[model samples]
Target: MAWLWLVLGGLFEVGFTTCLRNVDGFRHVGWTLGFLASVSLSMLLLEVAARSIPMGTAYAVWTGIGALGTVLTGIWLYGEPATPVRLLLVVGAVACIAGLKLTAGS
Candidate 1:
């Protein structure tokens, strides 16, 4: 259940971050509302996930997913640089998140 919340939180994190790109520096009201709502839902889900997951582990996983998703979206949708080095760094982040999850005994 807690893990489910973590997943949902990660999804919402991605949603909010993606919406942020459409906000046009907070000029778009609809995008702004979507961003705020998504962020709020993400935070609330994170709080729920913290009940059973260690704070450090949960936080790392949440942020890892969010960062990875955002960077991938940027590369795919915004034509950001997808250098080999950057890709490796993203892989490393994923490995660390996995390690934390495994070792945290969740």
Candidate 2:
């Protein structure tokens, strides 16, 4: 359950960041609101997950998911380049995230 919360938090972390990209320095009202909402939910979920998960593990997984998702979102939605090296690094990040999950003490 905590892991689920963590994952959801992480995904929301992605949502907030993606929304931020469209926020135009907080000038865009709709995107700014979206960012605010997503970030709030993300933080709430993270807190719930942290109740059981080790702090370091929870933080790493959360950040890892956000980072991975953000990169993919950039590539697919924003038309960012998917160079071989970048792809390989993303895969490595995924592996590291998985490793952290597998070895989490909680």
Indicate which candidate wins on TM-score: 2
For candidate 1, write residues 1-106 as lDDT tens digits.
8888997899899989999999999999999999999999999999999999999889888998899999999999999999999999999998988888789887
User: Could you give candidate 2's per-residue lDDT for residues 1-106 as a string of tens digits?
Assistant: 9999999999999999999999998999999999999999999999999999988999999999999999999999999999999999999999999999999977
Ten residues in a row with the worst lDDT in model 1? Answer: 97-106
Which regions in candidate 1 have their CA more than 4 angstroms from the true location? none
Q: In model 2, which range of ten residues has the least summed lDDT?
A: 97-106
lDDT measured at residue 14 in model 1 versus the true structure, 0 to 100: 91
**C-alpha lDDT of all candidate models, in order:** 0.92, 0.96
